[model samples]
Target: RLQRDQELTGVDVVVLDECHERHLDADTTAAFLWDVRQALRPELRLVAASATTDAEGWSRLLGGAPVVEAPGVSYPV
Candidate 1:
């Protein structure tokens, strides 16, 4: 999609929200998403957000890529 179509031409930054949704395991999805991103768009910044996942998996996928986490709101038990 990046070559035939300019899907990433004007994209300043790409935030891959809910990237883990694609995988049954959050960590597994992180690795998969990272590989997909690297294969598709290495320059575009990819971000992942989830209730049970964190930037560690993302780092592994991204080879120690930087991660900025925003504390998510939680409901009462």
Candidate 2:
């Protein structure tokens, strides 16, 4: 995001690839997610993909927001 000097507020949708990736810097990820939530205009959507509980946890974090989980061709477990 810094490449364009853009803030998350300029975004309308957030797609979290490999939602199972837990090693992403927590602060940075949280900041991005916070902005995604705050920047939305109520009708905005967030898409998280991963066959794991990580996606579900994110939904709960966003207060039961809608989540789209895509089925992976191969199981990570």
Best by lDDT: 2
Per-candidate TM-scores read 0.54, 0.54
Q: Could you give the C-alpha RMSD of every candidate to the true structure, in order shown?
A: 4.6, 4.1
- For candidate 1, the C-alpha RMSD (Å) to the true structure equals 4.6
Candidate 1: minimum summed lDDT over ten consecutive residues — where? 1-10
Q: How many backbone clashes are present in model 2? A: 0
Model 2 TM-score relative to the real fold: 0.54
For residues 1-77, could you state the per-residue lDDT of candidate 1 as single tens digits? 33454445666554556665665565554455456556766776666655566568766766787776767788899
Candidate 1 residue runs with Cα over 4 Å from true position: 1-7, 23-42
lDDT of 2 by residue, 1-77 (tens): 63343354566776666666667574476556666456644544566666665666888866797876555587579
lDDT of 1 at 60: 70
| Residue 15 in candidate 1, Cα distance off native in Å | 1.4
